[model samples]
Target: MLSGRLVKWMLLLSEYTITYELAKAVKGQAVVNFLAAHPVPDNETISDDFPYEQVMMIEPLNLWQMYFDGASKISGTGARVIFITPQGDLLPYSFTLVIGVYDHTPNYTRSPEEYPSAANSGRLLKGKVAIITGGARGIGAATAKLFALNGAHVIIADILDDLGPTLADSIDGRYIHCDVGRESDVESAVNLALAWRGQLDIMFSNAGVAGPFGSITNLDMDKMKDLLDVNICGMVHGIKHAARAMIRGKRGSIICTSSSAAIMGGLASHAYSLSKEAVLGLARSTACELGVHGIRVNCISPHGVPSEMLVTAYRNFFGKADMGPEEVGRIVGETGSLLRGRSASMEDVAQAALFLASDDAGFITAHNLIVDGGFTSAFSTMSFIYQ
Candidate 1:
């Protein structure tokens, strides 16, 4: 009897092989026929016969109005340039200024005295309201802080009553007890954000649990049920209620947190992987439904981050309570990776969520932004080839 994972992989392999072979065969035949009809003699090429070229046009790269501020001081030396596009897009660029022994030519003309920073930087999410599930800790916590810093009125929703209120208070945001497994809790959280801010702009459905692990033969049905309730049904509740509130505004961004295992098999437990995969399908389906109202739906699948849940999983797996983030990151990198040297971080995943929430990604929707550092792009066996 084949395992469930094996069955899934087999089906995927068969479908991919069939489609790829058919496409390759058709293209090969077309190329052969084309060459037969338009035969070329040896050493003959189009370069000599058609020795023609057209003059290229060049335009000034100044579509965005530039704002520059250069300063030098004992504290720091840097130059900040801000570009505001006609469409009201903001781009803040910071560069370090260094004056070395090559004194004849200084990079900057200004004298070292005054200090300058991006104190007047434009807030990407100004005047927006965001509700982040599982915001008390982990990726959701990072995202909540980032959103608040970017000028969004954030509402932290989580079951961690102790930490949730504290984080919310620090960010000047509100906190509500929300066990995503319950539909009423999710609906009420959305309502609270709406009531306080008068509208909902971003919804981050990020609460999830790593379900039962180990062999499929010993899989626990009770644990599987609980996993689906929080991971799948919870996300559904968020999307359903958030979309309703966003419809009133006619514009919003809904982001869900998935796992790298959702796209690639064998990276996580069966229940956890399945739940994350369901999130992608839900986002794609709901995006189509809410697109008319200008509500964008998307999900982010991040590779191993040293979250509380991940740390606990690592300790449980290795039976070592002393195992820290560095050890877990090294193990994950060795097991599955394309890019080396740096492991995926919570901030990286949060930045993805922030981008999708901001107007910079206004045209993006129904997309699964995988933040795996090229792990999904390369075959697992390719590591041996490089060695």
Candidate 2:
């Protein structure tokens, strides 16, 4: 029995989740002039230092992409966000925004070019500082270079006094001697990182060690303990100290280096695989704990990289002390990798580290990025059946 005009009004009001009682006459809205800066009687005054206090506002969405604000009810309008003081005075979003007391996640996006033009996504870590453990060689070293190239102040933390300092110098970075296996060393690295830039934004827990070829039946408990000390315990120490440093800023990214051996069996010694697998668990658990503090934890698992670690492991396993890295790389590319003709490289792992460290991956946490060319996701090729 409703008229079309009344039905149209109902639809319009429903858009705002508002309801009105029938039998009540429509009311007019009152406009209150708000003072930008003034003291209440016997109370402290407030003011805004943030620029451009206006009717238009910008806010970041849930993790990715820019939050384009839509037209909404204005301050002192029908729709409002309000707060009551102990003295029972009313405060709206506009009032606090005007006074610079609105503490929001986007408020932390104070960086220039935070909202860049459509042509670019902006610099990934333009004002950020990063620390890379095991940064003297291999994947850690590669990532350290990439991080610096992308505008982060890089810290190369490693036990290699000679190589670490040289690499740091090459990238205009600072070198700190740090063995992730030692808690004090890791703690010192984080402290040094904070000292250099007044903030620690990224921590790459890329330090690890491998064990020689052995089955679980022939497991060397002593060697297993040693590898665990470097691989598993080391990553945990990085996470522990990194979290302490990150908690102060209320935001950070921590990346751990695991391996495809963690996903596949018979690929590595029992101890190495066990330690890498343990990293996945550690990243996920700490991610859950530190996510509330805006800190992210993730792992990068690259399969069959031709790094010296794998080369040495292969040399010991096959009793080919004379074999070179290229030969071993070719063997892995042909036999183990699904993507034929191309062996994985340390740079590939470094690129994965870059993505996880950037704001482009803001919502990514507790993730295991397998840069394996589909090695772990498939069964063996079994080409004899096709032949």
Assess candidate 1 and give its lDDT.
0.72
Backbone clash tally for model 1?
Answer: 0
lDDT of 1 by residue, 25-139 (tens): 2232211110000112224432332211221111112111211233121221212222233553322211121111121221333321211122212245866999999999989
User: lDDT tens string, model 2, 230-260?
Assistant: 8999999999999999999999999999989
Q: Clashing pairs in model 1?
A: none
Which runs in model 1 stand beyond 4 Å of their true positions?
1-122, 380-387
Model 1 TM-score (2 dp): 0.70
Best by TM-score: 1
